[model samples]
Target chain A: MSEWWTYRPSSFLLFSARTYYRLFELYNAEIWPWQVLALLVGVAILVLLRKPGTWQGRTISALLAASWLWVAWAYLYSRYASINWMATYFAAAFALEALLLIVLGVGHGLVWRPPAAWISRAGIGLATFAVALQPLIGPLVGRSWSQVEVFAVAPDPTVVGTLGVLVLASGWPKWLLLPIPILWCLVSGATAWVMQSPDAALMPAAAALVIVAGGGSVLSRMAPARDASGTPALD
Target chain B: MDEIIKAPPLSRRRLLGALVATGAAAAVGPRISAAQPDAIITRPIPSTDEKLPAVGLGSWITFNVGYDDVARASCAEVMRDFFEAGGRLIDSSPMYGSSQATIGYGLYTLGKPPALFSADKVWTSPGSRGPPQIEVSRKQWNVPRFDLLQVHNLLAWKEHLPTLFAMKASGQLRYVGITTSEGRRHRDFEQIMRTQPLDFVQVSYNVLDREAEARILPLAQERGMAVIINRPFRQGALIDRVARHPLPSWAGEIGCVSWAQLLLKFIIAHPAVTCAIPATTRPAHARENVGAARGPLPDKVMRQRIESLVEQL
Candidate 1:
């Protein structure tokens, strides 16, 4: 089989999502062979980055394919009769998580295998910025965010802004990372109080908690492991 | 290979039953005679008295099979069989991916059946329903004057109803209805049924799903509006559940050869239900579904049996 045929599951998922989004926008569904072909290309690129003769590459590739399959299955299930918009929304969220897992697994596959280049670094930066800005830009520009006839601009910056700042500060010294989670929690909690949707509030609160808990473990590991001159032993 | 061939053959008694069932189908296999061209069970339009087939094709997941030449050809064949079998009302919408196009292709290929009852919808949020969206939907379906148009899922019902009414008055549309499925928006469904002068109401009511019976069915009956039942098999979940079990002996009494007939009979048994649209992709499935329209429907006792059997699942 050709490389494109190997990633059939990913192609199906991309095709389904694109079909749904197109149907939602245009009120007519059209065949999107190109979208399916594009997803196959993405899977091929991810697979090519893996080391040869290693189980890690095979495992990561399988995971990517499985995630895409799950996303496609979820999308199909959501389209069934008797499911509401809320259920559909949650199913779509699961699809997004599956996509994120593919990204993370692909990133892990490339880790320590090759020397990181400026282009790779810039790509990572771009991805990080996009992920961090989702909540900030989503509430403002996202068509689904508000109920009003005329689009209402978001009045307050979201918890994503705080996370974006923290990600930007991650390039600096370890001490700078300490206050980021604290600031994130305060802003997120305040936003949670103001937002109409519980989902909107819950997301930021959950992100804040993850940052604090995960960051604390990293801080504890860094503290005693530092050398006498206050530089990290690994460095 | 020797081990694989070890299974025994069926007994003579079982073989006889299969022959009998096949014979029964063959007896009723022919199309309606010229004397009764409208032989299929048809319910009337509330206002105009135009009778549509009691069993219509629901094109949801089936029509979304997409751009595959073989699949498209098969769909066209199924549709041709449907129309040749005296099917008139072809239900579709923008919600189902490429369903409208598939229906269009089938109708176009078959030279457009004279009594084509084209029904399509507009799915939008509340207060966003406007002429622009309606016009776009009209162009998408490629129908100059839709025979029956419905507001999809009560989407912007307040805004769209007036537009539909205006279109009806101006002869842009023949009839107008509002549809809500899955029993999600019953409150809105009830409100429309009570307030609006609708010709039909589409809902999800199957042998497995009886939620629509409480208020929607009775209200439609009382208001003298036609009712269309969507998801008659609960989107194939009911079929999967019933597959393991044998067809009850009593089901044969009602002339039901398969579970599809039994389920569809239950929906049509309701005087309120004008038609039930159950979607299928396979040609065999389509033939089986359309076969439901034939033969005697289940009476009160058999309907109770169906309800109990579905409840057991």
Candidate 2:
């Protein structure tokens, strides 16, 4: 048998760039008007991101949970899986992410820190892009408006939006919520790269942005920890 | 052995060669059809002496269109062109997402062209599930019975081969075989080829990818197994590369107008190969591919020359 490393990214592509994009066209047409509902949900999540409180956090989390569950069933399971065998596993991951959002984000009510000034700006920027700007990128790149990938309705924007929200909230929520979206960005980015899509850089760019922006805060917080003697301790 | 060595129509092939030499072959333009004397070129299945067209259709990435009415209708047009050009043998697998359904749509659109030599694969786990998976594939293609059923990529071949053998034994299938692509698992593939009563074995082979020539091709000849060549253009990469260079001056001798035909002819010209299935989305390309099967094939010396030239490019 050939070793796993023998495979290239192109080896896994079972459909063409045209076919992959046409899937979104067919899917978007099949579930009409739901795109508006999904957009409203994105708007709600953004609104709650600004009102920093326990109930607000829980509301944001619940909205995200519903968004993810909807994507898991409506897009990944029903539409994308028809062209990609790996989408079934992606749907399961989305469902798992939704479950985590419900249990950790909604039930426990994550703590929202007034993020470090730059981090807060970055978070709002990313959230805005995910909900609003990303959809327009599809149409700008010559794809029909019907094929536009919307927030919460498509995996790319959903994952990016979740990352933006996670950046605004602090603590263990990042540890639980960040990995799936980060991993999904990498997967979706690679898929776009293989398909030679114009938005090939967007997902990976989002991932890198979160890692640098999100990871920097963690390091900064770690730097402040000291012994009672007012000296840093060595491990 | 004699059944596999049928000669091309000398008189008509010479006429095609003459047209190519005169630079008039460009005007032939989808004129090749079953009604023409040299339109259909067939080779015998070694085990059964059943004739299959030299070129067949493969549905890898090309026909995986999922409910896109435009793409599905385009796929149907490709099928229409393929059948009109005297081609049969459409190959697909469950691993190819929605391809079976797309083919079903095409077949339904074409009224399930009687010339279709339906080829599909059994791909699933536990070996016990193979039969049900094949049934699902059968329903997807909407065919009464597949003309050939292969164990895809040698996945669970030890368990699935027996199921295929039993099906063949009971006359539920016309032929049984195994398949692998991109030059994988040749050692295990050979073991099955040697031990099993296989009618056909599909493998990846092209002008650039010749790893199969070392052992697989010779072994197939030795075992009397008809060979089906897959990835004849390395999923279009090889053709795209060679298309950059001009066709060799000697191409007209064999009536090949484009590099796709040359690459496909190189594969199907092998004595052990019964067919080479190259997938394409355009109806014009489908007709062009079937055109490769007609006219004279390269001899041993010319085959070596063609290989050497392609390697340098």
Candidate 3:
């Protein structure tokens, strides 16, 4: 019990950094041609978000759900759990996020409706950065491109990209979805910062962009949840 | 063994060479430390006549510095101080992040001592994952085998303990044990200790928490399983608590100078304890921790007096 309090925050951050750095190599080796499939899926989501017919919206949500499940199984349950036991809880959280995304985003027909405001523009920009620009971040910071972070593959960028889209979406109660993404960002950012990696800035910067784009305000105005009729849902 | 310190800066080849010649070769069973003339007081493993230094080092969060170069170097220095002070039995768990790796690095840099007892834990689920976790831990620790492999916190022990026993039978490891610190799972731990074919058992024991004294310690003594006492200073809480009050006037009677020594001396004083691993990141504190290993240990009367003083404080 006393040992629990004796932990220095740096110890945790340090563990996070080391874990992430190792993951970069492990993931890249594990997913190669699949990377092409993921990239195409990411591109498809963006294209669908631009036009967002009912089918397109459902397809985009389905794609995000698939990504979350993949990461949960591949990274958390199968790999990270071997190094740290707490990864089981992390996997559970990602699995929960996947289920929620399916229920709220797909079932409810939530779609990206990037408004013509700075916040929307910035939010879209963050979303784009998480998918496209974020991969280039490692190279710019002198990290090899081989270790580039990809959306739907890595936890950090996936959360960031999700936040950016949530903040910009026309959907109500995206506030309902902020907890997991926000938690993941804080977690990944702390890990990267402690490791002194370039990706450290990605999560925090995405978080700030979402807040500026009215993520929190929209969340505050929205109830914890809503029904099809737009009233707060009762248990 | 002396040739390690007398040798030049170690390369991977040199590390492997020293390992093949000294560390790995000499680690058949418990070997006495000649690094320091008066080896730290030791207790025997009842199953095997292996005598372990009563003071070991625990790699909890203190040694889990990930890949931070500076922090890793600090760990190496701590290990160096520990080695010079007649310490052995460096314990770690996979749950502690990069601690096993840090210990590997420290051992590589310091050149493994014959007295070095690499103790680590396999912490994962499902019996199948045990072998892989052990493999990873070995790679991280840069050793082919560990002296003692424990099931951390008794997670999946029934599933994992058999794997450990098989490994021990095959000579991949020397001893098998289970560890639960901070008094989390004593009932289960007691069951394992009482019934299982274990060589050692680690649990939280200090002047502050004497719950172990009532049963666990006595059971260990009776069953003849070597006991590794952890959380010796209550993770520095007891030390801080005692430091607030003056050191008892009878401090030197057990060769105590610092608060750390006082607390450690109390735990190591137990006849049941084969070792008390008090972890620290700083070299100076490591030195202070190892200091308790030397000189006269507190007798039973001294142990009671020290515990009472600490409880009052």
Candidate 4:
């Protein structure tokens, strides 16, 4: 880890931020009108989670998987890895996360009844933060518009929000879903720290929030069954 | 690695004169060659009779400052320090974000210094990307043409080599070279060196990472290829570790007043090494790095001792 730590902070940050800026500009120019569709889809997921309609889990997971796949192909593999070699591994992990989400939710046709617990409430807040508030972190911090990292369009917040939404899944596979977001946050945080970036605190902060909230939700879900029947809930 | 610079600006000329009057360049004491005064050392290019300075500035991360005005201004000052201290070779790549553009900006701030021996790299290609990337690189550097055009990390090199040769053959460039700053490609880099008709090669070579010493440096010598050493301070870690302690008593034998100069002098001392490009953003650090080019370089015996001393630290 120290060996990776040996790099000059600017080297990693410049490659990352520059690649991000380029992809952002390209995405903005080419997909100017279509971005509204992605935003509307994001709003639909939030509305579905708020009121458990038919196949709501399936819908949210499908949207989450699509976002992951898009960023994996468009940003990580196609753009970021061209400069930083580590992004190739990240792209693979993201693609795998997308497939897992699709199989677990879309394949099974699970219904998402939004949890009534405080942890799930907090998870909703986090998902909202990633979608609506995360993009503003860049502009509010004084970065140029070209350098803005938008959720669904950018890898970091897309993964962050996905983790928040997944934590609300009552019976979903938490183990399979948590690692990629956690790992990505660590990598992203280290990279930001190196770059002297304003968002340095955001990634590690997201990782910590995911661990506490995701783990708490899973624990809370297990506790009710174990207390009543003297058996672990997942089995 | 040689820095091609003009006569100093008036303010820096006064600073140089004052340093000379104080019996050293900056705070470095004594003289290895008093007659030469502050004249920077240069080594032959091997392929050509032209001499390159022993020290040059690298533009990997430090010079890739995008559009940040404060960072860009700092880069300009660093470039000024480098040229004023007799630097010439300013190396960059298309892979390094805005590095080529920043180098152009730094030089532009300095009135497009004549001492500039612009060196750049082509990082993309299916063969067609080479021409356009070079065109972009040329505009970024704001130079009519670069002194050297290198294949970056050997990516699509087979595809781009022909274009490089054609560029050189057509006088768009003076030298055609290949560069690999990663340890993973040392074997292939050596293979290319032995077989390719190259004028120069850049590689990661430093005190802590002596992997290049076994084969790459020797191959460059046997092949008469000019060598440019990167990561001489292991991308700032090695020197930062050594900088924690005071300089050793015998450090002055090669006239190193700082750990930066000591680390730099060690690399450039290798007779096969034509230049060592250490990137920096601070004008003070740039001046310190250029100091290694002055006075004397360490010989083989001293290089070993320098290695041993640094290891002990």
Candidate 5:
């Protein structure tokens, strides 16, 4: 079965850590031993997959493993040791996971590569600008900061997945990556309506507009015609 | 500050009558059987004019279990049982890992109760010199309107109290309270009660921790503000201390079957206290905690007996 089961080290690590944290809260000491066993299992899988990795993949994999370790440490520390510093440790681990993902994507040359014309590149740039501007506008408009995750020019899983598919199907304008931020903002804005906060709605709305308009402009510059080798002109 | 707000007032007597009618229709209403011989004690939230069972569940340690579907579903069942047995207050916080998210999920799946009193807190640094960061708290709890928003452990109380007061004026929150547990900030707790125009305050007030009664409880009663007692079990430390000993025979006279009831009943006996929130992960514990709400609260004389029972430990 052609299931969507292709392994990405970063995504798997993120999902596993999140799941373990949830289980830790529910079962506490009852499941602590099982979590330790799972950590070992995750390390074993990483070691087995280490051979076929590029420098970028290896680096990303190591960062992913580190994030999980941080999460486990946070859980243990909160349960058995210092209760006060647990939140700081958890937030730091979360931010590190986001940073590592961005670094891994850039290093692997996955982002900033346009499969289409220069217009598409410009469109992506505009989208990026829009996403970045969301936080500034959100508070002015009276939205909560948590809504920024949806509205701001932050990386989203769906957009990244789409970009990966597009890249593999046919090399288009590298700038196609730009619109992902815009798409995230739009979806985030729509979700904010239920939140019933003006600031919540405003931030996401602003982000969506920037990403879509800028990303559209960038995508427009790319030529559809293929070269003699049947690859697109940008590639 | 008195702007002659012309909102309709909720009648407590009428609301209580309506609630009792609904409780009767629900079939599993307050277990008032003569064989049980326990009168369920109910207390009113002065601000909202809503009466809730004296003992409520705290979701801090129990509900912070994260975002798993099965675990969340199990918690939903616990909440359902709690409400069916006449629970109204559900306490939570952003600081308890994914507790807010878990509560959001539970409330979503279980559907909200009309009389539900959602209480949460904003935990920031103590010496911080800015606003209480209300926006972050709103998102974390996933509630548009929080019934009671407390400053967790006097952390940035001066900063948060003003914002909470403003929210109260805006009709976004019905009550404003402050909480201090584990005996961390008695001085700050007394200071806030003395100065601020708060509607409620929460502190650790089990049989073991009666220091609040000396000053804090009387101050709250004088101020006419309700009180919520947390850490009634001393974060399970009290339980560990009293585990080997059997419950004294008189505990049954007041309808307390377990040590959990003995602890909660002692807290509820205080005149200033409106409710006591005990955190428990097990559903049976939730049921037993709620059962503490039933029967006659120990009188001043009996209160001394209950304390003496624990003092033996």
Candidate 6:
């Protein structure tokens, strides 16, 4: 087998940028009314995140799991696989991520709590960007609104959203869940860069921001507990 | 094809200065009249003596538009123009995303041009999967049978080669061959070319990438095998690099009005190359590519001149 160093990222790119954008246009048309529903689900997740609790955490996880499973089956398997053979493997990995989320949510793994620091606030902002601002990038970059990648539907925003959600989480779930979305963002960022898309930096940048926040969440956990007041409190 | 790019008349002193600077005495080379050929230029396939057009269409990234109807219709237009311009061969592989299905849509939309020469490839592992993949590729192209089928990138060639030979012997396929690109696997490529009874071999060769000239071209000539040249423009990078410069004044000796045609003429002018396949997404570019086959080609001296000038650029 040939070594990996011999090949460039563009060598594996089998589709044109125009074709890639058109894929989303056609997909959006085919799955009409679902975009509306997916957006509603995203809004519901945001609402749940505002008031963190055990039940709210599980509900948010269930919502995210449903979105991941839908994207794996419909977008990756049914659509993207037609052009790229690698999408099959991507769909399988996405399905696995969804299953992991299901276990963390239903198996009573971790409790969702309000952030005590600016890092968690940044995570919330990143999640908001994926759900709200990311779609606007398409039209701003000369693509049509029909081709805008939406959260809970497209892989880029979904992965970004998951990373954001993970930053609001802690314990083993945060450690276990961060790798998949980060890897996806890096892969997709390289792909978009090869395609010369203007918003290519968004995914990789979101991944970086989440990694910092997730790390901060860990450091906060190790530190002495603090109350609503500025001073440290008894455990 | 008849359009000649007129250069400002240079004085004897200027012509000599340009010639010295460019290291080409192309001004004094044997000059063919700048007349387009009345018929499309063709070279004989060494194995069966079948004449294939010197220029063919390649579907790499250009035709992998997936299921977008708008993009698919645009591709159909490109194909329609290619056929009307007297091109015969259209090449694709299963590795090129949805290019095969896109080609099928174009063929079906055009009601299947009788002049279409369908060339495809088998790219799967373990060799047993070759037949099923080939069947799917045939269905995708909506063709009765492929004119040529090659093993892509030499993957699983040990197993795929025998399967291709059997298909060719049974007449289910017309030609059997193998392909490699970007200059990888040439040692194995050379070994296969020397040993296999292949009808065609597709390789990457252009003005800049001349690794093929040292051994592969000569080997193909020695073995009496046909050669299909891929990436004549280095997948559009070469053209982009030279698009801003004016064509060397001596280019008119071969009737090349555009850099695209000049680079293409450089490839097919070689005696061993049966065809050069250049992929494009626009109908105008498709028409321009086939125009390379319609005029006088660069002679040995002029081919050398083209290489030097492009190298400097």
- Per-residue CA lDDT of model 2 for B19-91, tens digit only, reads 5534533433343221232445688888988888899999999999877889999999999988877788999
Clashing pairs in 4: B2-B52, B2-B53, B3-B87, B3-B88, B4-B88, B4-B115, B5-B115
Q: Which regions in candidate 2 have their CA more than 4 angstroms from the true location?
A: A225-235, B1-37
TM-scores for every candidate against the unseen true structure: 0.59, 0.91, 0.62, 0.71, 0.55, 0.91
Would candidate 6 be rated incorrect, acceptable, medium or high by CAPRI criteria?
medium
Which residue runs does candidate 5 get wrong by more than 4 Å?
A: A1-235, B1-39, B46-49, B125-136, B139-141
**Model 6 ranges with Cα > 4 A deviation:** A113-116, A223-234, B1-29, B33-36
- Expressed between 0 and 1, the share of native interface contacts present in candidate 1 is 0.00
Q: Where's the lowest-lDDT run of ten residues in candidate 2 chain A?
A: A1-10
Q: Model 6: per-residue lDDT, tens digit, B1-313?
A: 1222322355563354334323332333456433323346778888888878888999999999887788889999999878766688999999998899999999999999988989999999878999999999999999999999999989899999998899889999899899999898899999999999999999999999999999999999999888999999988899999999998777756656689989998998888898899999999888778878766778788889899999999
For each candidate, the DockQ is 0.05, 0.67, 0.11, 0.18, 0.02, 0.67
Task: Summarize candidate 4's per-residue lDDT along B90-162 as a digit string, tens digits.
Answer: 8998877767777888878899988798888888757678999899889988999899999988888888888
Candidate 3 lDDT tens digits, B1-313: 0111133365563354334334322332222222221335666887897777778998876776654567789899999878766687899988787688889999999887777998899888877899998999999999879999999878889999999999999999999999887676788888989899899999899988888988888998888898898888766667778787877656755556688987887887777888899988788788678767655566677677877887788
Winner of 3 and 5 under DockQ: 3
| TM-score winner between candidates 1 and 4 | 4
lDDT of 2 by residue, A113-163 (tens): 834778888888899899999999989998888789999898899889988
lDDT of 4 at A212: 79
Ranking by DockQ: 6, 2, 4, 3, 1, 5
RMSD of 2: 4.7
Cα deviation of B169, candidate 1, in Å? 0.6
Better of 4 and 5 by TM-score: 4
lDDT order, best first, reads 2, 6, 4, 3, 5, 1
* TM-scores, chain B, all models: 0.84, 0.89, 0.86, 0.90, 0.83, 0.89
What fraction of the native alpha-carbon contacts across the interface, defined at 8 angstroms, is recovered by model 3?
A: 0.14
